[model samples]
Target: MPLYENRINALNTIEIDQNLLKEVQVGNQSVAKTLVDKIIENKATKIAIEGWYGVDFKKIFNLIKEEAEKHNLTVTGKSSAGLYKSSEEIAQYSAKYLTDDPSFGWVNSDGHLRDLLNPKALQELRDLKSESDLLVVYGPGVAVEELSDLYDLVIYADYTMQPMLWQMWDGELIPFGSDEPDKNYFWKQYYYNDFYLLYRQKQYAYTKTDFYIDAVVPEELKLMSFKAYEAMIDEMVKYPIKQVKIMQPGPWGAYRYRDLWDIKGLECNAWNELAGIELSILIDIGLEKPINILTQNIMQRPLELVGEYVHKTFPELFPLQVWLDDGYFPEPVPWERSSMPIHNHPSTQYVQRHFNEPLGRYETYYIVESYKGSSTWMGYKEDADLEEWERLCRDSDNLKVIPNWEDFIKRWDTNVGDLFLIPPGTTHGHGGNQMILEMDTGPSIAGTEYSFFTYDFARNTWDDNTKTMTAKQMKMHLEHSFDNQKWIREGRVRSHHRPRPITQAGDGKYRYDQYETIDEMPFHIERIFMEEEAPGDTQGKFMQIVTLTEGERVTIVSKRDPRLRTTIDRLQACVIPASFGEHTYYNESGRHAMVVILRLKKG
Candidate 1:
C-alpha cells in the first residue's frame, strides 16, 4: 500500500498564519490603503514612500498622502535616491567596462545599481528621515545594503521575471527584436549566465527585504506579507498547476504547432529544451489576482509539493520536464533542413562529477504528428568508424563537412504512434518533418544544454545574426562529445529503445502504452488513450505529469471536488498533484483522446 494512502491531509502538517500572510499582499491598491491605515493608527505626523523603476513611487505616494490627509495626518513621498537608472544608462557603463556590442545598452545582467548609488542621493534620503512621521522606502535599491538605514519598513514589490522571449520594458510587453534598443541584447550578456544572475538576485532578495510581494498580476496589486507569502506556498504545492508555455525560435521550428496553440508572432522553431525547463505556474487560490511563480521555486519545497517520500528521494526539485519539439518541412524546401543536432547528454556520474547535477537527463519522444519521410536518428552502426567520425568532427569545426550519416548512424522510420527512449550517452535526434512530444528529466541547475552536439548537418540555427554569439556553444560541444560515444547494433538497439503497450485497466474505456525510459532510471512513461472516458486514482502514491497530446479538449475532474477541475486542450501539459487522490478524465470533445502520463517508479 502507498504510504500516503491514509494521510489525506499530508500538507496540513505544515503550519501557516493567515493573518500574517495577508499583511504582505502582492502589488495592489490595497497596499497604499494599508499604509494609510497604518499611519492613521500610529498617528504619525510624517510619512515617506520609496521604491524602484517601473513603479511610480511619486504617484503612489501622492495617492497615499491624499488618503492620510483625510485623517489629518501629513505625509511625504520620495522615490528611492540610489542607483536607479535606465537600461540605456547601464549600457553606457557597460560600453566603458564590459562588451563592445553596440546594443549592449539593453543588458541588465549586472546588478550594478547597488554599487553605484550617488552620495547626494544618500544625503537626500537622510534628509527625508527628519521630515516624515513614517518612511516607506521601497524599490530595487531599497534592499541594497548601502540603503539599509533609510527606511522604517521596506516593502519590495516585484513582478515575476519575464520570460526570455518577452520582457516588461516601461510597462509594455516588448519582444526581444533585432533593433537598436531591443537588439538581441541577451546574446551580448551571455544567455545562460544572465539568466543565472537574475535567478540569484531573486533568491537573494528574500534575505534582504523586510517584506516582499509579487506585483505581477496586472491591475490587481496584492501585497502578500513575506511571512504569509512564504507560508501560503503550501497552498501552491498541494494543488494541480499548469505551467505557462514558453516558446522560442529554432532552425527546425515550424509554425503549424504554434498556430494550432494560438501562440502568434513567434519564430516557432522549438517549444522547450531538455535543460532549460524553467517553468512558471499560475497560483489560482480562487483569487482575482492569481500569482505566477517559477516551478523551481515551488519544488524547492519538494516535501510540501511532491510529498515527503518523493522529496527525500529527490530533494529541492521536480524530477521531470516535458515539452514539445515541433518541426516542419514544406513541400519545396527553401533551405536544407536535417534532423536535430545529433547529440547525447552526459551520464549520471559524468554530470555529477563535471556539472554537479543531481540527475542526468533521460528523455522519451512520443510521436504525435508525422509527415512524409519522417524518421528519427538513434544508435549507430555496429561497425561504425570512430576514427573517421573524429576526423570529421575536428574538420567541421569551421567548415561545412557533410558525411554519410546513414552508413554510420542508425535510423528509425517513425510514425504517429512511435515512442523512443533517449537515455544519456545515447546518440539521438528527432528527424525533420515530425512533431515530437518530449518527456524528459529536468535540466541541470546551471541551465546549460547538457546534450553535446556532434553534427549539425552543416546547418545554422534560426538566428543568423546571432551566429557570432552562438559560436561559443561549439567549443563546449567539442570538449564533451568525444569520450561519451556508445555505438550499438540493430538487434541490441531494438531490445532497448523500442516502444510497447502495457496492460490497461480492464474498464474497457482506456488503453495504456508504456516505455522503459532508459535502464534503471527510476521513472517510466505511458500514454493513456481514452476511448470515451477513464477513471483512476493515484492511490496516494505519486504525482503525474499529464500532457494532452491528442484531443480537442479533455477535463480532469476531481472526485473529491468536482468544482476543482481543469480542462486541458490538445498539446498542453498540467501536473496532477499527488494529493489529488481520485480523479476521472472525461473526453469532453466527444472523440477519442490521448493523454501521455509520466510518473516515478513505485517502491
Candidate 2:
C-alpha cells in the first residue's frame, strides 16, 4: 500500500469567501447566458473575448452568437487573427530569438503582442463595430492595448498547462495568424514567442478585464467576476502554497514510486513537487471541483510571495525547484539500467553567454530513503583519464562503443538525511537504491534545457508507446560539457561538496542545525527537528521551501494568525511565503518531526 495519498485536500488550495464564491458561474450555458444578460442590460455594443493560446475561440463565439440571436440582435464575430501580421512576417521576426537550435532558444524579452499585429488589419477590425448590433472580437490579443478602447466589455479566458500541452501534441494548436501549426518550430515558437506574449497579455488582462473564465474544459467553463479573481488571489498569498505533483517515467526509473505514490501504469522516476511552469496549482473556492491554474499565477504578487530581494533578483520568475528522484528498488538491478546518465549543469556565466538565461542550474540531493548499496556519483576520480573518458563519450554517442563509467566517475555512499551539494560543472548521477529529494535553483524558461548530458553508458531507453525497451542512444553535448566541466577530484568532492552540519540553535523541545555550504552555493539547507513544535521566522526576507522528511504529518501555522495554516504530509513539500512571518511547526503525528528547510542565503 502507498504510504502517501496521491491527492491531499489541503495542498495547493485557496479557500474563497462564501460571498465571492456565490458569484462564480458553472457550465458553458450559464456563462454564455450571464454574458448575454449583461450585454442586454448594459446595452453594450462591442465585446472582446481574449483567450490563452490553446483556447477554442470558435466554440465560445458561437455560444454567444446563439444567445444574441434569441434576443433578435444581429451578432457578427471575427477572430483576433485578422489583426495579426502575416505568418511569414511573424516567423521572420521570431527567427532572431529562435536561432537554428532545435533544443534551445533565446528568451524573447522585448517582444510583445503588438509586434505581431498589422496596422491595416487593426483599422479593419475597428470598422466592424458599426456593422452589427453586437460586434464580438474574439481570440488571443483581442485585449491588447491597441484594442482596449475598441471593446465595451472584455472577457479573459484562461486554460491550464496540461490540456494546452496535449493540444499542441495533437497538432490542433495553431499559432495566431497561422492557418496550420509550424511542423518544425511548433514547440520552440510556442515556448519562446507565443506563450511568452500570451502570458504577458494575461498579466495585463488581470487588471483591466471585466470577467475571468476557466476554459480548461471547453464544455464546462467556469465564469467569475474580475473582483472575485482578485479576491481569491489576495487570500491565496496569505498562506503557504503547494503545487500538484507531476510524475515522469524515465529509462533510469526505479520501483520506489510504484510503492510510495498511487500512480498506475507508468513507472515513476521523477516526482516534481514544486517545479515552476511545469506544474499547476489547484484552487478551492467552495466549488464542486477545484480550479486548476498555472503555477506561475502565484507570481502575480511577487513581492509578497517571494520577497523584494528575490523578486528583484529573479524578476518574473520562481527562483527554486523541488522534486524527488526515486531510485529505490526492492532488488538490485544492472547498473546501466538503474543509474542516471552522467551529466552536468551549466554555470551562470556560461548560460548567460550561450543561452541568454537569467540563472544557472545549481542542484542538491538530500537522501530521504536509502537501501542496501545505495550510492551517488559525483566528480571524477583522482586517477581518472580525461582523454579516454572524452573519447569514450564521443564513441558512445555514435553507438560505436559502450563506456565503463565506473572507471572515471567517483561514487559516494548515501545515507538518510545526508546532503550533497552539486554545483554547476560537477559531473553527477543519482545512483539507484535511494530516494533523493532534489532541491535546486529554478531555471528560467529557456534555461531548463541547460543540463548538458555528457554520457549515458550506452544504455537503451524504455519506449512508453511500444511498451518495450528500444535501442535509442541519448544525445550528448560533449563540447559544452568539456568546456563547463570542473576537474574536482575525489578528495575535493568529499571535502568541499560534503560537509558536516553544526548546531545553530536548539531548545529542550526542538533543535536546529545549519549545514555547511560552499561559497558557490546561493542557497542554504537547515534541518529542524521538533519534539512537539518549533518556531521559525522568515524575517520578511526570502521564501522558505520545506519538505517534511519525517513524521506522519506536521502543521505550519502563522503565530500571529492561527487560521492561516497548512498541513504537510511525510515526504511532501510546501512553500512558506516570505510574507508568512513568525510561523511555527506543530508536530501533529506525536512523533519527532523532521523538516528540511531550503532558502536563499541572506546577503
Candidate 3:
C-alpha cells in the first residue's frame, strides 16, 4: 500500500457534473425578489437576513421589503444598528486588549460584536412579530444564538471581492500608505481583530442560514442552493487550481518582478503572500473575460478539496503558503543593500497559545537567481552573550545598538539551487540580488507572516510601514525570542541546512534532493532534477506543489489520463491535487529541467 492508501480509499473522488450547476439560479434583483416571495408564501411573519462582516445588506433587505408591501403585507425594516455598543466602548476595549504587549493576552476584543448585541434589540425584534405582518432584520451577527428564536425565517447574504492579477484584494491592502500612524494602529488592533470577528460571524452564518446569495458581482444575484455550493466545491477539487498573484511594493522591494511580469507603472519589489489560502478561482464562461470568484464562498464541502484527514485536521482552512520574493542589487554591492530586517518568527507553542493558531511558521528559501556576491543571514554565534544580544535588540530603535552583524549573525554565501531552512525563532533573512522561492508552513486559519525584528541597517528603511516596529512590539519580541533562539557554530548551521540526496530514478539520471526536515514539521521540501524527461508519481500519498525552478518550461502529464496536462513556465508554480495519483514531468523544450516540490508529510 502507498503512504496515503487509506486516505485515498476513504475519499469520495466524485466529480460533480457541470450541467447540474445550471439548476442554481443566477440573476439580479428579480431573482432576489423571487426568493423573498417564496419565503412570504411559506407564512413567514418575520425574517432576519445576515451577512459576513463588512457586507452591507441594506439593498437586499430593501428589495425584500418593497415586494412584501406590494403583497398587501405591512412591512417593517429594523436595522441591527441598535445592537451595536457605543464606539467609545469598542475603542476602550480595543486599546486594552489589542496592543503589541505580550502580557496583554487575548486574540480578540472583550464583549465584542455578538457579546455587545443589545438585549433590548432582541426584545424589539420579538415585538415586531405582533405589530407587523412582515419584518426584515439585516446586519452582521443577526445569526447569533441570541437572535435565533426571534425570526420565522433566516437568510444569509454574502459577497466576495473579486481579485485582479498582481493586485491586492479589497480588504487585504492597508490604504493611505503604511507610514501613516493610523495605518500602524489599525494593523496592531483593528485589522487583525476585525478579521477574527468576521471569521467567527462567517462560521456562524454557515449553520444558521436558510438561503444564500453570491452577491459577488454587484447588480447580480447568483442564487445557489446550499447543496449547489457543495457541488461547486466538489467540481473545483478535481482539477489543478491557481490563485491570482499580487505584486507588492515595499521599502526593500526591487524592480525585477515588475520587469519580468511586464507590469506597468510600478518599479518596486514583488512578493505574493498567502497564494494558496487567500484564494480566488478563475472560471472561464466562454466570455472575453473569465470571472474571478473567491474560493471561500464555495468552500461548502471542505473534505472534497483537502481530503478526509486534512479536512479533519485542518477543517477550517488550507495549511500551506507559497510566496515568491524577488530582490535585486548590482553585483559587487554592499551586503546591507539587499538584506532584510533581522527577525524571527514565533514558536508553534507561542503562536498557538497567544493567537489561537494551530501552528507557528517554518519557512525554507530556495534560491532561483544568485548574483556574484549573493549571501544570507541565519542563526547566531556560538559564544554570543545572551544579555548583550537582548540589550542590542531592545535598544536598536534608538541607534544605541550597533555591532558587527557578520561576527554574531551567521552569514552564508549563496548560489543557485541552494536551500536554507529557517525554523521558528531562528533569526534569518537573505541578501539582495537574488530571487528566492519561499515555501512556508502555516496553520489553517491564521495566515503566517509573523516576524519580530531585532535590527535593520538599511537607510530610509523605517519609512516602510512594516519596518516601523514600535517599542512595545520590540518588548514583545524580546519576551518571545528568548526560548526559541538557537546559537550554533557556523559548521552546524551548514550541516543542518545542506541539501542531501534522497533517491535516484531512470538509471540514476533523475534525482531527488531533500533540503532539511525538522521534528514534527507538517511539510517537507525537495528538488526534482529531470535529465531530459522523467515520470513523476504522487503514489496516492500527498498533494505536491511544483514550481519550475530552471529551464524554459515543463509539462505535467496525467499518467492515467494523458489528455489532462498542465504546462508551467519558468518560475511559475502549480498544485497537484492529492487525488492525482500518478503523473509525469516532461521537458517539452528537450532540455534538462529542475523543479522544486513542496509536499505534506506522509503519515
Candidate 4:
C-alpha cells in the first residue's frame, strides 16, 4: 500500500475527522474548550493502561487480536517491525540485552520506536486501531529512559509546557521556556513507583549500578535527568481523570453498547505521574518545531475546565472511585517478591506462611467501607508499613505489628481465606501471606520503596554497583516494610463485594420511602437451612441474604429489646438493614429457615 494511503486508511478507520482542525482563537478559554471538546465530540477516548504484565496486557492484546482478524490490516512492514514514517512518530529505539537479565532481553535507551516495537505487537495494535479508530501509540518514555518504548509516550511538565505531538494536538507551542525537570521530579527507586508494574520482585533504587541511592549529585545534567523521572510521576498523580469515562463521552444518542452506571472518578495515578514527567521531557526536546507550540498549549490548559466539561457530559465522572489496580509493594532486593519467596518480614511473615502458594488459593471478597462521603479515599496519607522487629528474643516494646484481619475485612465484604497479589492493584489491607504477585506500571523495580520490603533475617549490606544484596540489604531486610514510594502515583484501590438490592414489597404495610415505620443500616445474619443443599425460599415474608449460588438463608440473634414496635415478618420477604439488632436475631419467632440478614442504605 502507498504511504498516504496507509496514513489515510489508519485515520479513516478510527473515524477521526482529519478535515483541517480549527485553529485557536488566541487568549481565549473557548478555544481551549473547543479543542478539548472536539476530542470528545469525535467520540475520542484517551485511555492509559500500563501494559507491562503479560496477562494484564492481554486485555488490549485480545482487543487488538479480534480487531486485526477482522480488519485485514495485518500486513508486515518493511523491517517486519513497522513502516511507521518518521513524521508519524516522535522517536524510535535500539535495544541492548544482558546475559543475566533474560526475561526482557532487549533494553533500548534511545532512538526509534521501531527498534523496540516487535513487528507482531505493532500489527496487533494497528489492527485494533483500524476497527476502533483509537490511535494507540506506545509511549516515548520507554525509548528515552532505559526501557522498551512499547507505546507512544506523553509527559506532563509542571510549567505551561508540552512536546511536539501534543503541540500538534493543540496547534501551539509553549510560551514559557521552562526547559527541564527540577529536583522535585527525582525519586529513589527505594519508593518503587509504588510497586505497581515492577511487581513484588524488586526494590525501587536497586538497579545493578554503581550509584548509592543517597549519594548526592551536584545540580548537574545527570542530576536533572534523575529528577526528570520524579517529575514524570508527579504529573500523572495529580491530573484528574475518570477511568469509566475514559472509554465513553457524549450521549449514546438512542442506544449504547454498554451500561455506564458505575460512574467512577478513581484514577490509576501510575500512568498519570509517569505521563506528567514524560511530557516535561518531550516539551524540553521539542523546543524548536511547529509541534512545540501546539503541545505546549494542550498541556497548559488548566484542569478545572477539563473537569467541568467531563462532568457536564458524563454523570459518572463525579463521585467516581473504582480504581481496579495499584502495584505497590516496596522492596529492597531486585528479585525479592511478596509471594514468590516468603521471608521473615516480621509483620507479614505469618500471613505469608499460611497462604503461601501451592497450598492456598487467592480468595475474593467485597470491600464494604471504602466510601468517605461520596468519593473514595485514594490518598494513602496513613501508609501501613512493617516496622523494625526488636526481637522475639526480647518482648519489651518492639514487637513488629502484623496487619490485622480487621484492617483487611473492615473495608470490603471479605472472607478469611483470601490471598492477594502485590505490586499492581494491591491493597495494604490484603497484604497477607500469599506469593506476592508482583506486577507494576513501569519496568524499573526502583518504584517499590514504599509500604513494604523483604525483611533480612540477618543484617547484610546492599551493593551499590550490583544493585544487589550486600550487608545493608540485610539490615534493611529485617522487619522489611519501608513504604517510601507512596508518591509513585499508581492508583491502588481497595476492593470488596456487594449484595443485591432489598426494597419494600407491595401490600406489606411498608412503602419504600414513606411507609416504613422504622429504619436501619447494618446487621449480623445467621442462616437456618433445612439442608445445606436446599434451595432457600426466594419467596415469602422472610429476611434473607440471596446469592446467585445454590442456597439462601438468614438468621440473627439480637441482644437489644424492641419496645412497642411490632416486627414486620408477615410479608413474603422484607429486609431489615441490620439483622434485628446487635448480637440478637429475635423476631418473636424461632428458627425461620432460609433467613439471611444484611446491612444496606437506600436512596
| Candidate 2: segments with Cα more than 4 A from true spot | 1-17, 179-185, 445-447
lDDT scores of the candidates, listed in order: 0.58, 0.79, 0.60, 0.22
Could you give me the TM-score of model 2 versus the true structure?
Answer: 0.94
lDDT of 1 by residue, 58-136 (tens): 4455556676677665555544434344456544544433344232212233444454355566566666544545555
Q: What's the distance in Å from true for residue 19, model 1?
A: 9.7
- Cα lDDT tens digits, model 2, 1-603, are 011214454355567778888778888888889899989988999999987867788888889999889899889887787788887898898887778865667777767888899988887777653668998888888888877888789998888666676667667786788545544546777766777788788877766799888888888888898888888878888888776666666677677766655665554464445445456677777787667667677788888888998788778877878888888777778777778888888777887787677788888999999999888999899899988888888777735546467889998998998899999999998888888888888767422546778887766666656645573866678778888888677888889998667888898789998889999998988889999999888888778888899898898999988888888888888888888989999999988999988888952
Best-fitting candidate, measured by lDDT? 2
Q: Please count the clashing residue pairs in each candidate, in the order shown.
A: 22, 0, 3, 125
Better of 1 and 4 by lDDT: 1
Q: Which candidate tops TM-score?
A: 2
What count of clashes does model 2 give?
A: 0
What's the residue-level lDDT of 14 in candidate 3?
28
Measured by C-alpha RMSD in angstroms, how accurate is candidate 2?
A: 2.8
TM-score of each: 0.74, 0.94, 0.79, 0.20
Cα miss at 594, model 1 (Å)? 2.0
514-581 per-residue lDDT for model 3 (tens digits): 65576635678877888777677666546677888888788887788875566777777766666666
Winner on lDDT (1 vs 2): 2
Query: Which order, best to worst by lDDT?
Result: 2, 3, 1, 4
